[model samples]
Target: MDLDDDILYEDDSGNESSENGDDQFMEMNMEPESSSSQKRDEVDDFQFEILTPDKIVSHMVDCIKEVNAVVEIPATTTRILLNHFRWDKEKLMERYYDGDQDKLFTEAHVISPHRSIVSKPKKTTRQTAAASSAEVTCEICFLSLPSKGLTGLECGHKFCTLCWTEYLTTKIMDEGMGQTISCAAHKCDILVDDATVMSLIRDPRVKLKYQHLITNSFVECNRLMRWCPAPDCGNAVKVAYSDAKPALCSCGHRFCFACGENWHEPVRCVWLKKWIRKCDDDSETSNWIAANTKECPKCRITIEKDGGCNHMICKNQNCKADFCWVCLGPWEPHGSSWYNCNRFDEDDAKKARDNQELSRSMLQRYLFYCNRYMNHMQSLKFEHKLYASIKVKMEEMQQHNMSWIEVQFLHKAVDVLCQCRQTLMFTYVFAFYLKKNNQSIIFEDNQKDLENSTETLSEFLERDITSELLVDIKQKVQDKYRYCESRRKVLLDHVYEGYDKDWWEYIDI
Candidate 1:
């Protein structure tokens, strides 16, 4: 019988049967027979078809080629393709044949061996190709750079370190980035991050160059500069050279040691002093002899001695009249010359009498101003007392749990009264200064009129029972009080705003 067909004939003790039955009988002889023996014998006797190694290899090769042909596959997918080719080749050979199949498997697993190979030479070639593709050149400095050396900002523009650092340093020095530092590139708003700077400065030599540009070439103040030490003076003090001692502030005021102004004893350097005298007239003289040189006390004009013995002549056109060198009086020849007389003594006496009269007139004016200032202060004290009384009453009313609307109305009233009182007080203070100094009385009289008007309006509001009347009174008081306040601010501004620089220098604390 055919191997694919069932067996037909069998013999056992003259009995006829199929070969399958005979085979089963023979299998029963090989082991302990069991109830499942019939099923086991049928299974052992069956024939089935199996795929050969060549056919499996061919299928795997076709699958790999199809996957590789697809464009833009991800790296993971590409890795899967390589792994499948390797795994299927080994699996096929294990199941069908156990001999070496290196050449057959190699041909099936890889396509274009030069391109798909993962050897060292192939990897090196790929890296070289990537480097060449990514190389860029700086636009500003026109320097060629390797792809890795280039840095891209948020704007997506790449720049070399040298050009970017120079640009940033200029911007920081000139237009200080007080709150924010934005990109220097035109129309680009990217803010520079600190990491970008650190990354670009990998080369030590390039980093040193960048630092020099930042510290030296930039116009920013050096660390040695300090704020002025004068109390309430917000000016900055800077010196050109750190090693050189700075000159003192001309106002004769001292500052902290770090403020670049320190007092030191003046040293006598002959040549230097002479040169300074030519350049600056205020240079202090060297010795007692130099100090005694005749200089006009009023104008400090130097008088040269010429054509006279033991006497100086005043050649100044304004003071050409004769004067004594000792006393600066009208020059009277000491030796009983033609000009010697007691008439000089009589002239001096008359001048002293005139000075006494002038002093009396000045005293009278000062006393009158002082009395006016005292009267103004008294009026202010009266207004202050009235305001304090009203404030206390308002506070008491608030603590009694009044309606919010009523409380708010009372608060507004109290606020208006307090503000009116402040305006009056400030005006009084300003008037007091003007009066005490015997200066112009116009400002004082004007302030006094405003005070009276404000006080009357405030009193009217307090006495008025109707809310409408009180509102009207409040509006009037605010208008009048605000006018006075504005005037006071103007006056104070004039007095304090443009103070002399020397005035600030004298602040001790």
Candidate 2:
């Protein structure tokens, strides 16, 4: 597939509008590709999907299938061989095809019971003898159990089910050694495979834990694979590029495929991580930028804004005074703590918006995204009126009060909500490298207005229905939601217009 397949154009004319930032947007005039062609192109790209439990099992089976096809071995033996190599199919292929077959099998702890005396390798004679033993002592717990109640790895080191259960449970739950748990036999270093571990462990929950650890090891240990860092999201990202760069997961997580951190393109992973920690460390330190740190005018000590209000009262007991959050001026001129001044003047706002070109400081843009992202996220909390509305929608659904999935749009609306928030967050990253010009100015202002309205809407959405201001809040929330969403559309449209029309002369370095 060509780059053009991934990137569509703006318009039929493919023309750039005039210098003025008005009535401009990407047309995306390309004719839609046929479904078959589109699917072919999708396959051409390195595609990744979140594998389900069944899919994971199928993936392992596929590996076994391919390994068997190459080596002509039993699928169970192939599974063990693959696990022994940490699922490195290439190494398994090379070793089995190009290297000594007996060495590979012996190292992997696999022995074919069907092999007769004539077919048995000299190296596997010891394994054959051990498997023929009528009674074996359990290495762990030093207990005598029936041979049928025991399991052994490639090394013929057998352990009773009770001992294996206890060992496996400890490794999975306490030691977190599920991926590296070895045979309990003294001086035996054979790594236990998932099937053997599951067979030995009786508890379904513990077996699941063991399986999860092995599955996670593929992404955790493999160079080409990366697990999404999002909380509770289980996604493995497999990219074609071997270089260190960002990759997006199916779960909406964009992370550095190389470093396993959030996308930080212009900065190195180490510095980015350090910067993130310096800004986000809890218990010891609060996120400086996200928390909006500014010096207290009275105390001259660093303080963070703790509320949505612009009027701030200094927490310093020695210098208890009120001041403006924006300019550090006294709060007295604007009485009743009701004054709004963070809305900077046009000239100051213009300068602040494009300050990235000169200083290359990402502080403002980072803060903007952090605040808006958190605002949208916090708005989704259970206490908010939005959830109440969602509850009503669910009740309507349960009672069959409405037909044709009347509340279906809620899912789409929330999806759009999250999408817009993410676009707003990443737009700043793009803006940080953009030239300070009319385009940047327009986009920045759009962002600022959208953010203001979003916060206002979030505030309104949080208001209790029983409150006297409920009607007013509802009206305000609706108004802000429309305005914010519309502005966001225009902002993204303009950016897409620029990208499609190739508007950038040179990105800011």
Candidate 3:
């Protein structure tokens, strides 16, 4: 099967479901065995609902209505308050009820209609003349216009409708602001409401862009939500709570909701972020240089002795200090010798060699883990080919008188293999930063067992199959993949256990 068209989904219960239809890949009991474990396992059933742009907008409206029902405020103002609180209704309620009402509205950049009214300021001659003539001066355009031509927020900072359109358009299109677009009046912190934006902006393209910006802001600010990181995918996953857990998007992309990277378990978001930065940086290049190159003792300028004699001289024009490449000692001290320097056995020379070797060892250690990490990453990139090959195998098995459901084991095997590879890939990342200890040794052992089984399963799947040996191959493939799956779970369980027991220790990069 083309796995792209039939993407697999795993719910909180660990039962697998394919999006193409009701065909389940696997089913297993998820009930906790004891009451003590029930609480922990309950989190396994954590629910989330995937939302489209329209649904997200509807949800935002519902939230505004819900809060408005209790607070009895205008729906427009409620939206601003909800956004200010990052759509956290409970926290908004707590602050609204337990704190100063005027202060809350002030912070949210809105004038509270419920606030006590103050004495009105005396009108200027121009204001009186405008009031009498039913015309007002627009501060932005400096043009006198009819009172109906101007608009303003509750803060009473008014501007012409044309100026409002230009200002809102500039903010929405240029600055990419939606929910936080403040008033056009100078020094005015009052926000422009969605109703005002819709009423003023008539262009459909700008309106759609505004709506998109609003939806983006809603999802980005909400703690329980995240936009699927897949390219061109507009779906957002809204969860019951925030966590560093794996989330599969409707577009068939699986990623960690916390940091929006590929679903990397065993390793964490912080370490993965650090590792990515390390990989992107020239830190390893510097390490290689430190390990392979020698610096001049007199001027501390780095030099790489690619060839020639040991009587090395500093390349610096001002500080041409002569030194021996073998011991890095003064050339005068090795006058009787060419390649040999007696200072090679000296304390300073030994320390210098030891430091270089230490750097070399550190680089080698990083490469040991990095190479494996990169190998699995490259393998993962070509997993689609594996899936296509398995589809062919399934067809071959069916031609040998096997039923459709009977050949699903091939798909299951490939699924398990991919899962193992993914987990194994991140295990190397986890191991890279892990401090050596008994627990880490055990973790490494588990990693090795899983890796060996995964490679064996991969080999079995990639081997050519004949109709004569289909029966025997089917049994072996199933058994090997099952073993791989179990091993993967075992490794993950041990890592989770290490986390729970505080058995894992980490080293700073």
Ranking by lDDT: 3, 2, 1
Indicate the TM-score of model 3: 0.84
lDDT of 2 by residue, 419-441 (tens): 45555555545554567777778
Residue ranges of candidate 3 with Cα displaced over 4 Å: 1-43, 118-136, 326-329, 338-355
Model 2 clash count equals 1
What does each candidate score in C-alpha RMSD?
A: 37.0, 18.2, 10.6
- Candidates 1 and 3 compared: the better one by lDDT is 3
Which stretches of candidate 1 lie above 4 Å from their native place?
A: 1-353, 392-468, 498-509
Poorest 10 consecutive residues by lDDT, candidate 2: 20-29
Better of 1 and 2 by lDDT: 2
Candidate 3 lDDT, 313-339, residue by residue in tens: 887999999878878778887767676
lDDT per residue (tens digit) for residues 64-94 in model 1: 3344444233222222333434334234335
What's the CA error at residue 302 for candidate 1, in Å? 43
Give me the overall lDDT of model 3: 0.79
Candidate number with greatest TM-score: 3
Ranking by TM-score: 3, 2, 1
